[model samples]
Target chain A: MLDSESPTKSPMKTGESATRATTRDRLAAASLWLPVVILSVTATLWSRRLPAELPVEWLGNEGGAFRSTAVFSGITGTFALFAAVAGIIALAGVAATIRPWLVLVAGMVGGSATAAWLVAAGFGLAGEPMPASAVPWMVALVLAAASYGVVPYLLSSRQRRVRLGDAAAGVPLGVGEAGAWFTTIRVRVFGVFAAVSTLAAAVIAVLLVPRDAVGASAAIVALLLVAAGFLVFSRLRVSVDHRGLRVVSSLFRFPIAHVELNRIVSARSAELRAAEWGGWGYRVMPGRTAIVVSGRRGILVERDNGTHFAVTVPNPDLPVALLTTLVSR
Target chain B: MLYKVDPASAVTIADQLAVQVRVAVADGSLAPGTRLPPARELANALSINMHTVLRAYAQLRDDGILEMRQGRGASVRADAAAGTVRLVELADALLAEARKLGVGIPDVLILIQKRGTHA
Candidate 1:
């Protein structure tokens, strides 16, 4: 039977101090998604511009088409400014069930605008074929966006109690938490899957899709569907190796959440009465918002936001112990 | 009212709690089956981590000084009297050491008397 005690309350509480650290890390993680989105959108736009049969009209230099470009740039930049602001807001919602929506909106707006601008300013003016290099970048952009969609689904694994067969068999904790993470086949497999899908998407964009449209529309749609397939496939395979206590998803293997035993000021396993600790995902429970997850009855660690890490794992205390060991060292 | 614990003291929080709980038991202040405060409440009272109290309780339980039950909280075990014998002996030894150190018998007595009040 489970222990119903209050567990331990960590000295670290959510206060004014952690605001800076939370903001900084959010920006860093959020920034990684941006470039990847931009590159993919550029690829898609360039692909559309690559088709031979599309009508090409050149605006005369007589009119202020250049001013029109400036106006176009201004309009797009305004949209970007809104997106950047929205990104900040979304980062705050990192603990939410659908917080990724913020990233989605930001990526779509930023990527589409940049793609249109590149086609109009560069390709349209030169009346030349799409640069070979741009193709990979565009593919990357789509893959990155797709990845953003895939991550939350994978990271949010089913929260049932761990089964007998699922525990980490004989892997020694001597390798330390990080070593344990690296040694897991499930984690490495996801990492490889993500890499291969990314490479596959890039290859298809660069080589398979022809420059002309005997069936350009169909070809582009197919490429997108293929990228989407990889994205979904990657998400479905994501699982947590509880014995290993590492986040395993296609393409992501880093230790996102673990409690270092020594650094852990307290460990609590409680059934929350109210949203006393607030809603699920990383939240502040009378303390820092570094890593808090609200489940049926889960563990709580008292540490700075970045200090304690949370993942959906079986036998919550195992990861808690693993985290404690990592931090204690 | 304010006894400072040496931050570098090798003494674990569990040991510290054992000392407190044992004192209460030895003096008959907390009768057998008396429910001690929950780990969380005691930890808050002492301004320490809840785990410390838990460790203390677990150690005490193993030593047959306290009994813990789900939902019901921890209580003084029936064998607390036996645990107190050790507590009394330790006190006697510490007093004896003070006398050997050339402290007056009156001074040693006063110190024990004062501590006994707190206990």
Candidate 2:
């Protein structure tokens, strides 16, 4: 149940902050997607400018990169075909269910764009075929693009309109009564999985994998990803008090939300099924956003901004009452 | 379990934190081996001094509610759950009764010490 990161993520999985779909957000999306769009257009332009074939380099030879010619049209044609197929699948599977469309765009465009740019950035200007030497830079480019994709996703996850259901009153507070609620939830299964992979990568690098450049570099990339997985799949800390509701995930101390009291309309305890949330971690839909984890039962906080945030925790009674009391006063 | 401390309340912040640990253990919100947030981090969250959180965690460690390590922060003791629940319940009842009887906290402690020696 703790496994949120499979190869195929539910398209419904979204940013924690599901800000309403707005022109401003779309502008930001355009800005972020700008680089990819440029790369795509530029790559095609270069393909047209280049002669019939691209100079492909085979670096496997012990001494130097062997220059071999391959048809640029073939690679470009394959990419176009792949993009079409992926477009169809994503449109069929993701567009119908995903909220705010831009996420779907990011999923589709971000992927193929990275694929296109990886090739174009490497060999487009080089004129000479790429060698084993160029492979490292290609890897770096892919990583850079992936991290760039995350930034826009994080931005888009910022705000959304939630269905304002019947408002519930908070627990009444007595005079001079003050309280705070705190809980930390860690992912058991995912954490273990990350730990195992991290250990395996370290072991392979240190003990088993030969010290060759490719082997060591592959191990390092695996280690880097595992490190990121550790952060993403780590723990979350929650507290609600006079300060309103606060959630801090261990993802580089990424604050999921810091909803203030005056901005909060109401709060209630509810059973959050995973089905409603797509899959675990932080999920965003048109009407809801959730930081889901174990125990399923959690407190839902409705903000003055008309967005609702749900977080999973073992015990909700005290926090619910605490939020209730604080809000009622 | 919610860790709440009200400066405006009669109870000290340290005791508020320490007692919350027992209640959490008692109620199973914090299971055995659950790693508590470091004193500094939790203090920042609660807007209190780091030392206050340290004092609370130190007291819990002394009473066997938690185990503190140099770098790993504090965690609930494995055997502290069942016993601490009953202890917390009795303590709550005792405090309520003490309030009704107008008995001061110092006197309650002295009474417990006397009872402890006899038992």
Candidate 3:
């Protein structure tokens, strides 16, 4: 079961606090969806200004065929795309289920579609033959918007606090007793390495495959990886409370593992090597899962069910001591 | 909030746990109707016997400070604050009266017991 006092709930309480928190959450959601909304509006406006016919397909290097159906479809498609993206963002935000990747995907797809439609509309308005040059600009615009949009959303959402009243108290404790321990760890060196590697790989791929679409797709993949790497490798949060020990990625606040303290048979400090664990972020081998990043010191917890869990943190002594004391008790 | 019990301390774990709970209730750190950690979990965390934790919880329940039911963990009683306040007031008055009369706690207890037995 999940930890009873996990930081998933908003810290803001009822009355004035709740109202202020809700407003802040909504504003954050709006900021995340702003790029998509702006592109959608721009697409709609551009589509209206286009001539009755739109170039659907290029017949040759110099000429292309125009279809009135294509123009209407583009306009309708733009509106539908905006509505769908807006609805998803709104629901995710209000329900507090918003995932960073989901927003990134929405931004990429929405931005790309909007940009494509806008380019075609621009061609229709200018009465110029479709040119190859426009493709690169369109691809670059989409990639840039999608990549940059994720950063602010991720940063803003991390500021949200978890309140005690919002959580279902797992069990009663003696008054004046501490029932939980929580901390977030950021591995700066590893995150930077991962981000740089992703960008380098994207650059190499673009050089190898000169096609506009391929380059754009590669750029999108690279950006997504960089964003995900920043979230996964940069900040890891560990929480131990009455319910269990929860390790989560700070960006998504999604649990990497939730281990019940009762089920833990033993816990001790151990020297962890990335080579032994098959390297990196989160590794699962056989009956063991290891969260290894940077440091070589970690706490190895053996569960009653015969499974093992290890997490490498800078200072594992306190966590190990706490875990050992709890398990032994 | 935080709950802690030092196994190496001179005080019994049960007494330590009970004192902590009483102090928290008296100070309003634990609001009325707040569910407490389960006895089993508390015992595990403190490295003490589950029965010891239960004993502490029972002490609180008897004082009208907590409510416990099977399957549902312990929670602070709705009137626990008022109950705790009254307890403190009576304890202070008793302590002051005993001090003024140069009577020990044992003597006071014996006097009360003698009166109860005769009645």
Chain B TM-score of all predictions, in order?
A: 0.62, 0.72, 0.71
Better of 2 and 3 by TM-score: 2
Q: Superposing all C-alpha atoms, what RMSD in Å does each candidate have to the true structure?
A: 20.3, 10.9, 19.0
Ordered list by DockQ, greatest first: 2, 3, 1
Model 3 agreement with the true structure over A160-264: per-residue lDDT tens digits:
211112212123333434344444577888677767767776775666556655566666677667767666757776756555566877656576788888888
DockQ of 2: 0.17
Q: Candidate 3 chain B, which ten residues in sequence have the lowest lDDT sum? A: B1-10
What C-alpha lDDT, on a 0 to 100 scale, does residue B86 get in candidate 2? 84
Give a tens-digit lDDT track for model 1, residues A1-329. Answer: 01111212323233223222244335533653454455445545655444332111322123343435445555555655565565555444222322344445565665555544554446545566456666556545534544443333233222221111111112123431221111111223434554665566566567656654365456556656655443332321111122222232222323344443344543443333123234433453222332222234444445444333333322344334333444444
lDDT of each: 0.45, 0.62, 0.60
Off by over 4 Å in 3: A1-103, A110-329, B82-119
Could you tell me how far off, in angstroms, the CA of residue A230 lies in candidate 2 after the best superposition?
3.1
Give the alpha carbon lDDT tens digit for every residue of B4-104 in model 1. Answer: 12234577656756766666676665568766656764554345678977998897787677899998668888777955648755765877798789888
Using DockQ, give the best candidate's number: 2
Interface RMSD values for the candidates, listed in order? 18.7, 8.5, 10.3
Model 3 chain A poorest 10 in a row by lDDT: A160-169
- DockQ for candidate 3: 0.05
